[model samples]
Target: MSYENKILQMKKLLKKNNTQHVIEKEPILKPDVPNYAGIWQDAGLKMIENDFGVVFLLEKHYPLDYKHGAIYLRELYDAFGKWQQTQNAHPISLTDANNLIFYDTETTGLKGVGTHIFLNGLLEESEDGFTLKQYVLADPSNEVAFLFESKFWQGRKTIITYNGKSFDWPQLQTRWTLNKKDLPPLKEHDHLDLFHGSKRIWKNDIARMKLTQVEEEKLGFTRLDDVPGYLAPIIYLDAVKSGQPDALLKVLQHNEWDLLSLLTLYVQATNLLCEGIAEESATTYTNIGKWYADLREIDRSEELLQQVTNQYTREEAVNAYYHLGFQQKKQQNYIEARKSFQQALPYLQGRQQIIALIELAKIFEHRDKNYEFALEMTKQALKLVTESSLWTKESKTLRLADIQKRKNRLERKK
Candidate 1:
């Protein structure tokens, strides 16, 4: 019989065995037929089976002494407790590093029906050092199995991801719904999405706030000859169709590096925020100061802002002085506040300078009762606002009117 006739005969036999069996079985390639497990094993991936289906897993161990950039894996373990307390969620003390999981996923697309996660990467501290485990969906059919067998999510309190809150978690939830499976307990975990923190701390300092960009520029780590993330889905699909493990190996490597980078980024960010890494740039210090100010950590904010003021002589440092002055003024440290505002003047220009002058005017008039000095500062601010092109006519007029009123009040007091 011809090949087409034989295929038809096999379909008929399958229908006769179960007429309701309309689902076509995925074909195993010629190489895969002889040794199904050897295909993944040869690629250094181990096959694991569960109730739902089979998943390929790869595990790597890095020693405590292993350093990525400036941080040791052990330092990351040490910093998690402090980092957890600073997040917006209610503090759940994560002292044991084993309970913390750094997770990331590579999906087919950004969102909606067609997209599926092909790989899930997780990093956690182990007895020796750090262990990175990657669960690969060798076949799309095994995705449910992969999700079910993800024992790492069970009994773990904290999960750290770069942008997992908005993108990764939501995609997983969608996948669970599509598969008619319940969402994992990871939802209840103390999830820390580093994207928000990264933006708050490094937005001004970095060229771009992307994870890769942060890894390269801020953390001093870069991937060598790694596959770009955008090409991940394409490579994964080709691997699945062709039953070839080569492309999938690259995907796994890319994902493993991503997880490692996330661990390093987390450590670096925490160190900058909590332990205070020395020799940081002016903008980095200023951004951290602003972050602390937002958190109402007044002492930390002052310390970081002071560092920016003392170590740098640039436009960014002027903003730091302004923030420092504002914090000091809030604490009623009028002398230090006045000095900070004064120091900020030479570095500022246009609207910023005008604003600083107005602040100084207020301090002079209200706190020091130096009415003549206050009047002089107000007059200087009014002149700058009226002459400067930075402000709109209406804005300038309102500011000029406010400064003029201040000048009038100072004159009356004098």
Candidate 2:
């Protein structure tokens, strides 16, 4: 069936199933009228028209006292500005508060041409604090109108969202293409996907990295009486079909909260990044140290890893010490690197222990020129592999053979 025909069929099914509970008991609005000013006004929303078509919008201003989590909204905005400056990639020009847009969308389903974006929520910093503007597609046919009317993609320098790069933005692009609408110049904006940053920082602490989980656990924001996003399509279909504003209101509320949470999460994550990992958990410090190391921030990485080694248990400190040793070795601090490697050996077990042994053996042989010590370390590693059940006999035999070669070479040097 044609896409338009499919949409018409879905609308028919929705209207046929609309009960009084789903539809408002008031007089029904005629479908022939393209304008929904009266209906939207009655529902506490404003209908606005652009060159594209008529779309419904609701704008709300939140005061400085509005608390998303532990931090007030104003404080969050300040932190976000600070965080943006610190980011090496996609450095945001936060000189104008209006340049940034925190965006989130509620869609009919995960993906594809059939799915439609029902709502788009955006939070921008205004002179009177923070302003949240939501564009609602009262009818699926108004999707283009809503997207065009919002103008979020045009003026913004930075667009922040949770998993939007993978899901939300792509879905919108697909819809725009299917509708043959001109794609907005979103390429001009720096898109920051909070999902990647959140996962990098909090994956060890929070197992499930969903936006809701991040809100509750990390930001300390709890949502109340909100509809799940998956059920949004059903509720939206019912509302559109029945011409009722109730379910759509709930969807708008949910979308608004999502945008607010995105702001909170972005602020929290950026604050954490800027403040350093001094107060975080041992594992967090170690993980963050590794992340910095990957980014080649050698001094900062060493400092954090050293904190883990100083305060955490041997088991907790093992990997940190290994990383610290590697960093030291890169800087040619052989003596300090040796101490770190030795500190790690006692806590390491299984494959890690074997790896540590090889590392120490290399350090002794190559750096210290201590052939006897290198041979001893290699012999010990071979003995452990022979006795332990960690490796299969064939694997152990191969390791033994490799170790034997190292031992023979070292002994000959001695």
Tell how far residue 324 is off in model 1, in angstroms.
0.8
lDDT of each: 0.79, 0.77
**Per-residue lDDT of model 2, residues 155-271, tens digit only:** 636788889999988877777666543436434467888888778777577879988898888788888898988889998777777777778899899888888888777667656
lDDT of 2 at 130: 88
- Tens digits of per-residue lDDT, candidate 1, 319-348, equal 898888889989999999999999889888
Report the backbone clash tally of model 2: 0
- For each of the candidates, the C-alpha root-mean-square deviation to the true structure, in angstroms, is 10.8, 11.8
Best-matching candidate per lDDT: 1
Worst 10 residues of 1 by lDDT: 27-36
Model 1 regions more than 4 Å off: 1-38, 78-94, 181-187, 314-316, 349-351, 383-401, 407-414
Question: What are the TM-scores, per candidate, against the unseen true structure?
Answer: 0.81, 0.80
